[model samples]
Each structure stands twice: as structure tokens, then as C-alpha cells.
Target chain A: MKSVEPIFNDGFAGQPPAKRALGYIEDQKKNGKHVVGIYCGYAPVELMIALDLTPAVLCAFSNATIETAEATLPANLCPLIKSSYGFIEKDACPFYWAAEAVIAETTCDGKKKMFELIASRKPLHVMDLPQLCDEPEALDNWTTMIKKLKGFLEKTFEVQADDEAIEQAIRENNQKNRLVMEMLDHSALENPVLGWAEMLDIVFYATPGRGKLINDTLEKGVKVLQARVQNGYVHGRKGAPRILITGCPTAGDAAKVFKIIEEAGGVIVALDSCTGMKPFSEMIAENTGDPLRAIAQRYLKIPCACMTPNTRRLFELDRMIAKYRPDAVIDIVLQACHGYHVESFKVGKHIGERHHLPFLKIVTDYSPGDIGQLTTRIEGLIESIER
Target chain B: MSRSAGIDIGSRTIKLIVIDNGEVVVRKKRPSTYNPMGLCDYLLEGVSYDTIVATGYGRHLFKNYRKGEVITELKAFAVGAAHIAPSCGTVLDIGGQDTKAITIDPKGGVERFEMNDKCAAGTGRFLEIMAAALGFRYEEFAQEARLASRAEPINNMCTVFAESEVISLVTQGVPRSEIALGIHKSIVSRAINILKRVSTGRTLMFAGGVALNSCVAGLLREELGVEVIIPDDPQLVGALGCALHGQRS
Candidate 1:
């Protein structure tokens, strides 16, 4: 389990390993190995790994300077798309130069056009996945899509993926999934070995094909953490409320919500967010006879804030609440996120009315300094819960 | 005498309103440009003001005011709607670029609000795009829509696709007004979807630039099955909200 260097280097030549890696990908292509790049979050990373092709996930560029995205996209487009457009205009993304084919799912209307626009720019193949809100239909559509994708890969790579290769890939991916899930479980232990923030850093770094190394490090850290907790070194004082946080990135102001809860004696028992649990959830179902259906089923169940019409979020919340037995539920909705903000309130009200549970709502942006007010609010919420 | 000013720098237009002792002394709207400070200065050329509050997409970019408070358009709309129609419980503002439905408490506080910030399906920008496609000015487009006897809504959600659908309707010898009405109805339907997501109940007050378009408003009211209230000058609602913020502070 060795950690690979970060994907992007200052310049192509500055990092010899990364440059050599890119060259290796090019050589692989010359040797008839297909190269595919998948967009971040909800991508079938394991399936792609099983395919034996180099799979790089697309993350929005860190530095963006362009302001006017209205010319290309509608003014009302989501910030993520706007920012990604800005990144493209600025030529900041390294993926623009490397990958032979790119794929994006139709998660939102903004992302739909993002795929179309990127495809229009160059002769890139785009996979239009149906919105997963339609339950069985969505699962069926996704399975059909994966089979079509596998066919495309076979044709593009000019390699025959026999049953053995597919099965072996699925086995390797399942093992990887088990390790990642185990790491997540160990990381969640009360007063566990690793610091949450440090673990998140590892998660971000590991996303670019370093999962095994991260799992190993986390496995060791978890052992130490478990011993400390058993020795009562991680105990909190008398009356802290147990809680669960659901959000993205878990950095900046959003992460501050968790800090406030912890300070108020609330231990975050479990989380159901892409930045938390969704990244390494249950593996692509191993036992299903049809691998594509298994992959689709596994993805449809992944926790996403953007779940629409047939979203199982309410069910997920109920399950998390029962498992964690938290005093209250706090839903952090980021500004300009129409999907999450709308869903958060509905879920909050449902949880309050049906389950007789208390719900707290926190609206936030990217600033971490706003935690002072947030802390006060959480403390008040904790007081109310205690009463 | 304490004089306050509220400037709303929207994506398409910049609006300024000077309020002195709860009276709106001046109200003006101008095209929003690269420099919002310049636009504000032009609008407030001879006007003297005390506290200034700005809200909208470009609110944070303007730095010419003495004391400025930047608030989201949602909060600003709530404050503005409550000031004019005290009985209004829900505020539905469709701006040039975005649409929002805000449910207000009886005491004029925002209980909950939902906004359409991801697409142009129900926005004034969508109308403008439709109008441009039909070879008519935005003002004429709504009037022509009024003349429509019946509307057959084009159901595609994507703006690019919807625009093409409108062109096909034109090609098939459908009357312009009917197509325009259909476009308006489509916009209303999209808006209603969002309103349904976060609505408390019927009592909705419609504001923002799109509220002035009678055809869109009419379709929206018909679709929601609720009487929609439009302010005297709906475009200035965000600026008016900023002015009201000044009054409260």
C-alpha cells in the first residue's frame, strides 16, 4: 500500500513521477489500452478499476479567475457548473490535456449542459445517465448504460473482456471496497485513533488511486484509537448530545457546524454525506448474477444530497437516527444549492412531525470564520435538547 | 431627517430607491454594467443619502456607499413584500435571471423559502430568450401573449431544447401569441414545480421583473390556483427591500 504523488504538478516537468505516469498512460494507449476519465463523486471508480484502464476522476480546478460565465451558460446555472466553466476558460484543469474520453452524469440541468458543452469542445464520448430519482427505472437505465459503456470500452481498447477478466476485476474492486469500508468504520469509532480533519485530508489525497495505502495507515491508526477509547481516554463529560452531520466537503464553515456540536458535548456518531460516508459505501453488489445491475443498485443507494422525487433520504435519515440515537438532527444547507436547501427543510419537517425529533437548520457559505455565531446557535440547540 | 438608500444590483438591471422617513423619494432602474459603483453614482447623481444597503448578485461588488449591508435577494424580497402587503404570507419573485418562492410568517418573518437558481426555465431571461427567438421585443412578446386564445405548452425542460420547440411551433403555422402564451405557461409550470416544493399555502405575492409580465403572471396564478399579488413597481422590490432594511436598522 504505497501512496502515489498528488495528480497535478506545478508544471508537467516539475514532478518526474507524475510526468512519467502520464507518459505511461500515453504508452498504454499506444499499446491499445483505453484511457477514461470520470467526473468526481458517484462515478463507478471500482468498475473502472476492474476494467484495467487508467481511470482519473475530475475535480474542479482549485484556482479560478474568470467571473463572467453568463455568456456561455445561463445566468441561473449552479455555481459548480459556473466555476467549472470558469476553470475551463482559465485553462487550469490538467484533465483537459490528458484523457482520451470523458464521462459525466445528468445529475442536474447544469451538469447536463456541462457534459454537452465539454463534449462539444472536443471529440469526447459522453455517457448520459438517467436521473436516479426514478427508482427501478433509474436502476434499469443505469445498468443498461454500464453495459453500453463496457461495450464501448471493449471496442475502444480493442481488447476482449472475457468473463474471467470481468470477474477478477469485480473481485479486486470488492476487496478494495471492503478495505475502504473498514477504514471508514474504524475512523468513526468514538474517540477513534485518527483526527477527523486529518482523515479527510487522507481521503482527498487517496482519491487519485492511493486507497490501499490510506487504508493501511488508517488501519494502524484505528488500532491505537480503539485502545485509547477502551482505556477511557476519549470520554466526554456528563451530558453531551450524540448527533449525525450530513453535508459535503466537511471543510470551511460547514465543518464548523460539527465543531460547534462537539464543543456543546455532542458526539457525531455517524454521517451520511458524499464527503463522509458515500465515498466508500457498500461495494458494487458482489453476489448479483448481472454485474451491471449490481453496480446500478449499489450506486442508486449511495447517499447524495441531490436526491430528488423518489429520494430515500427520509428513510436514510430515519435509519441513521435510530442507529446513532442522536438528540437532534442538524441539516446544513449551503447557499445557492437549490436542491439540498429545498430537500433539507422538507426532511427536517418530516423528521420533526413524524418521529417527534428536534431538527436544526444551518445555512452556510465557504467561510470558516462564521463559526462563532454557529457555535452559539448549536449551544442553544443542545440546551433545548437537554431540556 | 434621516435619509437612506437601497440599491439592488441584479444580473440584468441595477435599481436604486431613496427612502426618507418611510417615503420613497426617488426610484430608478438602469442596465447593470461591469462597474456597479458607477451605475449607482449615475442613479444617485444629485441625491444625498445616509445609510445605504445593497442586495443582489452584484451587491458585494459595489463599494461606493458610506455604510453598506449586503443581504441575499431572498431576505430582501421578504422585507420588501412585507412592507407593501403586510398581509402577504408567501412571496414569489421571478427576476430576470432567477425565480424564488418564499413563505412568510404572519408577523412578516421568512418561515421558509425555495429558489430556482439552477436553470432559466421560469425566469425573465427565459422569456427574453423566447422573445428573441420569435423576432419580437420582450415588451411586445407579453402583449402578443395576451391576445392568445389558447396555449399549448411546450414540455421540454431544457431552455435550448424549448427554444427549438418554439421555432418548430412557428414553422407549423401556430400563431405567435399562442406560442408566446405556451412559452409563458411552460415557464409558469416550471415555477410551480419549485413553489410546490417549499410552499406553505396559497397566499403568494409575486414580485421582481417577471411579475410585470401580465401573461406570465396570469399563467402562474392559473397554474398555482391562487390569486397572485403584484406590487406597483415589482422590479424595484429588491431595492425597496433594501430601503426597508434601512428603516428597520
Candidate 2:
């Protein structure tokens, strides 16, 4: 399949940050720099940066390695877990081999168990993530876990992360978050300055890469999009149905749903997945005397489906719908992902009853076989909105 | 006055209906073989209409070939059912490869709809497979099931597994009629679960080729305890709706 070029104004374009990050990792590895592969948004990559170690996102987004992973894993498990394990076992992903170690969190049962199998292959650390963020002891519990991770990283890399170093890392990471949020805000315009593919490219590529290079790349992207908005260079049709996409983490091959929605003439305005707005929507408070506590507070508020009594996610969805004012909402759930699939009822009800917007939940996998069915459903949704 | 035409290129069959001055002037149906486009061409040959609308599984392929408007079967069924039975509160369509249940607003608009995902458990194709497994033709399958003394209670819904279950029961000395009745009951239960999700009123319009099965139709009425309206030619509803849309546009 032909890859989509990211939309830009005034001929501003470059290689996707995801690819550039891989090159950076290889270059840094040659310099004898310590690198840590991280999975899930809950892993504190900020701590890795504070220790002067490179943090690379190790989540798998393609279906190529899933067949290899499925030989040991069950075919009914979530595709994301399978793909991630597949890449590690098959040694297909360069970033996985480049990392000196991997950091995983207890975000979901599937990942927690999969991390056990991974420990035998590589040096790995697993953080026991608290699922109930609303409990009074949740913050303290999570802060301890964050401190433990910091201790592990310091010992593993043979580097001492002083308060000054962590403070500097927190400040720089907060700036990166702000730049990303600014780039995403461009889509909120009546005539969006970014297309769906462009937005996905910007978020997925920028979020995983580390240091001044990725930050500068993101800043340049925001500047280009801002310039486009100023010149009234919109990416999509002016009056197309604006859609807000919410559900599981969508990137790589799973991005087919987003492409289908855009092809059906719907402009995506907000993405509520981990690959999009979820991780960067909030920032770590730089002014805090204890940056670890601040980071703990922010990451716990991610509102992932694995959390019990996940009212915060619904509140965030309400806030996004009000801000973006999308004509409809589409929830993309990967097949066998019970958390997102079961939570879709609450999401649909909230959107329908409170916001009074049309809601569609598309349960799919990482295969191309269901492209035809997806197109029909998305087109039907657009038609309903038109009427 | 010039006429408007609608063609539904379904998985099993292709249906065409032409409307002139707000009246149905032509109606045709043909088996949709491997090449649905060729069969669609055959169905449209010599049928004159000023406007054309295509729907069903092959609607997109038809649009690429004919360059005309297309609508999803979900909307098509709601419009057609409302027009056929003005008081229709919902529509349940069990087509060749998929099934749909749609709730309609009083203004003939689709309020909400649901379609079976990537699975063909309670569709017309499911019934045909089970009928063949029992060594009965499609037309006689419903009659045989209706004449059974009691349903033997088939437990499987997956088409392949259900066929295996039927074979196992046949070898166990269970009567063919009882097994046929069991198959009908299983399919009806599946359709009922889909219908219950979308139906809010007592009146429902049943469409698709599966509606022609007397045992299925009788079971739906018996099970739901509501008014079930089956149009004269149930499979032609989508084509009729497309024709109506062509007339308006």
C-alpha cells in the first residue's frame, strides 16, 4: 500500500519523526549511550531522560510480526500485545535490539503477563500500576512505584540522577508536551489546518522520540501548521462532518479506521487514544519541589480503560466534545480488547444522552480483510449526519 | 415521463425496480453469480430510466461502473420499510450474508441501526446451508420444519458447526423434520436478539429473502407477540427504496 504524505503548507516537509527517532537511537547506541525501551504511556520516560538515557517507544503497530508472536501467544489475545511480543521474539524491530533494557507497567492483564515471558530474554522492570486512581491512597502508591522506577534506572545505567537533573528533564518534557498540544489544537479550527493522517503522523512520531531533536522537530511542525492557519490553507473540505475519534490506542496498521473516516469526507478533530491526546493532554507541573509526585499525578489521570470507575475518561471526553464540537464520535476498539470493547457502552450512552451526538463503535483487528465493511459503516454514519 | 431505477446487487441475488410517475412499472430478480457486475448489467439491459441508485454489498462496485448515487443498505431498508408499511417502527433484514435491524423515526429517517459483524450466523445463507445439510430444498425446508411435532433444540449458531451438529443428530436417529424445526428455532432466536436491541414499537417490517420462509415468519410473529409485516416481494425492498431515492433526486 502507498503511504500517505503528511499535509504541509508552503512545501514544508521532512521524514516522519518516528523514522528519525530510529536513526537517533542507532547513532546514540554507537556513542555507548544507555537506552531503555518503554511500553505504555504510564511508564515514566521522563525519569529515563533525567538519567541521561534514551527512551524509545517499543509498542508494535504493524501486523507483520503478529504471526510469529501468535505461535506462543493465544490468537484471541489483543493484537497490540501479540505484535509487541512478536517483534521482540522475531527481532524485527531495530529499537528493541538497540535498547539495553525494557520498562513495562501493569496497565492491563495482557501486558502484565506478556512482560513475564519477556523478562527471560532481556533485562526488564515492571511497575505495579494502581488501577483505581480515585482511591485516596492511589497517588501515594503510584508515587512509590515512580520512585522505584527511578531507582532501577539509576542503578541499571550506572548513573546518578540528582534533583537538578530531574528538574531540568521535567522542564524540557513539559515544553515538549505544550508544543504537541499546540499542534493538535490546529485541527479545532472551523477549517482544520491538519488532516487525519497528518495529525496521526505528528502525534505517533513525536511522542516516542526523545531530547532536543524530537522537541525541535515538533516545534517546527507546530510552526508550519500555525503558519498554514494564518494563511487560511486548510487541509480538508470546509463543511465536512467533523468527527472525534476515541477508544483504544490506534497507530501503525490499525490506522486504517482513521483513513476510512477521512475518505468518507469526515474531518477528524480530536483523538482520545494513547497515541494521540491522552498522554500529552496534561503536563507535569514544573514548579513542583518534588517532580516525581507531579509526574505520578499526571500519568495516573490518563483514564485508560483498565482503571476501575473510570469517570475521568468520560469527563475528558465531555470536555473534548464541547471544545472540538464534532458532528459525531467514532470509537475504534481492537478485536479481543475487552476493556475498550466493554467500556464502549458507557461511551456511547454518554455521547448519545448527554452530548446528543451520533456514536459508532467499530470493533476491528490488525487485518486488511475488513476494509470493505469498515468503509460501509463509516459512510453510512456520514450519510446519517448529512441527513 | 421518464422513469427512475434502483438496483440492489446483493451477495446471493440482484434485484432491480423501476418507478415511473410514482408507480412501480418494472421489477426483476436474478441470481448474483461470481460476476455480479455482469448480472447487474443483464438486469439493467433494456430497462430505461433517467436516474439510477445502487445499494447492497456491490453498491460501491456498481457506482464505480455506472457513476451514480449509492446508499447503504441500513438506510435503504428503513426507507423502504416505512414506505411499505407506513406505521413500521422497525425493520429486520436477514440477507444472503448479513443481517440488519434498524429503528425508524416517524418521519421515515433511520434513528439507529445494527448489523451483524464479519459473521454469517443468522442470515439467509445460514438457512440455505442447514437446508442442504438436511437434504431438503430451500422451498420445501420451511414446510418440513413447520410440520414437525417438536423442535429438537439445536444449540449451535456458527454455520459450519451447526451443520456438523445437524449431521450428528441425523446419525442419532432423530427425525429430519425435528432437526429442521430446531434449525429454524435457532435462527429465529438469533434474529430476535438483534431485533430486541433496535425495536421500540409493536410493529416491525421484515424484509430480505429469508422472510419468505413460512416457518421463520410464523416463528417471528409467535416469538415477538407483535405485528410483523412482510411486503409482497420482501427481497425487493432495498431496490424499491433506491428507486424512490432516485425519483426524489
Best by DockQ: 2
Candidate 1 lDDT over B1-249, as tens digits, reads 588888888877899998998899999999878877778778889988888888877665663354587666776787898888888888888887777777765545555555553455668888889999999898899899888899867887577888899899999999888988888888888778778866736678989989989888887777777767899999998898888877777
Per-residue alpha-carbon lDDT of model 2 for A185-295, expressed as tens digits? Answer: 988888887866677666666565567877887777777777787777767778899999999988778888888888888989998998888888888888688889988
Instruction: Name the lDDT value of residue A84 in candidate 1.
Output: 60
Model 2 regions more than 4 Å off: A1-21, A27-32
Cα lDDT tens digits for candidate 2, B146-169: 999999999999999999999999
Cα deviation in Å at residue A216, candidate 2? Answer: 2.7
* lDDT by residue (tens digit), candidate 1, A233-337: 433443356666664445422465776677666766566665555566566656556766777777777656666653577777777666556667777665556
Q: What TM-score quantifies how close candidate 1 is to the native fold?
A: 0.56
Relative to the true interface, what fraction of contacts does candidate 1 keep? 0.00
TM-score, chain B, each candidate: 0.93, 0.98
**DockQ comparisons of all candidates to the true complex:** 0.03, 0.57
Error of 1 at A64 (Å): 12
Off by over 4 Å in 1: A1-199, A205-275, A279-316, A319-387, B63-67
